[model samples]
Target: MTAKEPSVFRQGFKDGLPIGIGYFSVAFSFGIAAVSSGISWWQAVLISFTNLTSSGQFAGIGLIASFASYIEMALTEFVINMRYTLMGISLSQKLSPAFKMPFKLTLGHCNTDEIFAVAMSRQGEVSPAYMGGLSILPYVGWTGGTLAGAVLGNILPFSLSQALGIMIYGMFMAIIIPAARRERPVLFVVLTSVIISCIIYFVPAFSFITSGFSIIICAVAASALAAWLHPVEGEVADET
Candidate 1:
């Protein structure tokens, strides 16, 4: 291994540190939410460790709590996490030729939005050692925060635990509000999703739709409408 490779790995690790810190706070809220939804603390931690997806995991726990069907859960997760497939494809272009399939598969599992953005911003092809270093701390932070929050949820007052769970929603809003303000298409899609979700939640006729299915429908319908209305005309510019 070249000495330069170790330096590159260290740089990646340093770049990922802040992301790891941010993930801890968000994952804490998820942990609380998961446990409050009637799952055991260990189960919540296990989900966080394996899934590494905030929105999908939260939705999955909600489905589990409501006794939703397996198919519903599977489809809901698939729809919500479909973006990751695109992200993986994009990141593949940035990978060094020496980054083998096994390492690529491992890195793909933890390729969250922040991690992907950081990696893509780099000047050249990403090496396996760099990707490995980039992934480690965030993975640890997410799982460790889940364990902490899950244990605390079991001990904290029910009211306090519930309040902590609201943090996750606030985090989502913080992410959406900025993007929606910057892009008209994003705002339109957000509004469409919200309207459809509310209709599914409040209308008596739509009560047959399970929470998982409702999420899938809202996301797909909103995204489809947005894409149809504002289709990209050419190769999309990299925002990174």
Candidate 2:
């Protein structure tokens, strides 16, 4: 008899394991940062649970700590997370017939960067079951790690908690450095964003710009510059 093939859900779960593990470490740092920023441990965990995007959450907590306005927070989050909208559009093409509107709405919450990459890399149409399985572990790991870190932040010495908070920066660098090395466009965009951010933060002329607006400006300006400099070679497909 032939060996049985793994179920699609099982396959997705297996593929998501590494991503889940990675999320735990990064989310731990986020948890520490959140608590250190003056939020309660439960609040930190709640942020992680509700907003799965790492960068957005980090920026958001900073804004929260600085007592930014609701509009600033909303705009900043919308700008940072706009990529997910694009990712959702791309994945729409690959959804199986069984992946209906309700499933799409539910799973869209879990359509994170890593998850999007994994889903896009798969062969043929992706099923709802597979997406469900892929999301479970990462969600748990992120939330669980935040809970662990937030609680530990209360118990650990202040210096140590501050040190642990730096891990998230390292994680972002690790992610960006490799891709930036491989692609000139990536490098250019990264450098441009960094420069713009520095200018906004350090230049007295731009001192009036709040942290939240500064982030929005950097992201939009860098991305717009990159697109102008290196436009992708594709025609806009018309939706009939």
Candidate 3:
């Protein structure tokens, strides 16, 4: 509302543009996966619109397809998305003091990994106007792409629909690789997490564990290890 606030908002929008573009393809993949897994197109859109979390939504769709119990779905969603709580806490510190509880609630609803990263990369306190701007485009891209992809999933060739499912993983790699390349600690954490995940996935002993639990174990173990080996000063951080 201040005269200078518009510029902050504009900068946030500019920063979030790439994330919005990236979300389209990833959400496209989710839409395909959701529909292929037997959900209706509009249902898939509703999931994306309400949740806006890639891992959480994918896990929910899987559980839904399997006809898992409500408790099962609830646990999976909590384990997969508990990291968002930390992300919200971290981003909260970076916000300008004027960003009150109401603004925090609004901004927190749409805080994804990329949005958090973009907001943190800035040098100063993040503004509420800026956070609002940052959330807009990605929200549109995610909801819009899900709707589009769900419609397309109905008509696309089976082979093509299957192929599109991998785009979400590609988007994840795009986010991780650059940071891994720049930081040894990050690279170590990623590799450790992957190795642990593979073990839990393939080993007979852990085969009994559900996918959600496996992810929770691998993530927490690798992150704890990383924190022990390479801690960041002035903040407690965990890799999700």
| lDDT, each prediction | 0.81, 0.81, 0.82
Candidate number with greatest TM-score: 3
State every prediction's TM-score relative to the real structure.
Answer: 0.68, 0.68, 0.79
* Clash pairs for candidate 2: none
Query: How many times do residue backbones clash in model 2?
Result: 0
lDDT of 3 by residue, 104-211 (tens): 777878888788877776667788989898888899989888888888756767787677566656656877798899889989989998999899888998888766
Instruction: Summarize candidate 2's per-residue lDDT along 1-240 as a digit string, tens digits.
Output: 013223888889997787787788778888888999999999999999999988899999999999999998998888777767766888887887778889988887999888887877677777888898899889998999899888875676777656755654564576678868987887999999999999899999999886656766887799889989987444322121
lDDT of 1 by residue, 1-240 (tens): 567898988988998787677677678878888888999999999998899888899889999999999998888898777767767877987778778889877877888877877787677677888888888888888898888888865575767656655654664575678878988998999999999999999999999886656776887799889989998444343322
Q: What local lDDT score does residue 150 receive in model 3, on the 0 to 100 scale?
A: 85
Q: lDDT (0-100) at residue 23 of candidate 1?
A: 75
Candidate 1, overall lDDT? 0.81
Number of the top candidate by lDDT?
3
Per-residue lDDT value at 207 in model 2 = 96
Show where candidate 3 strays beyond 4 Å: 1-4, 36-38, 154-164, 235-240
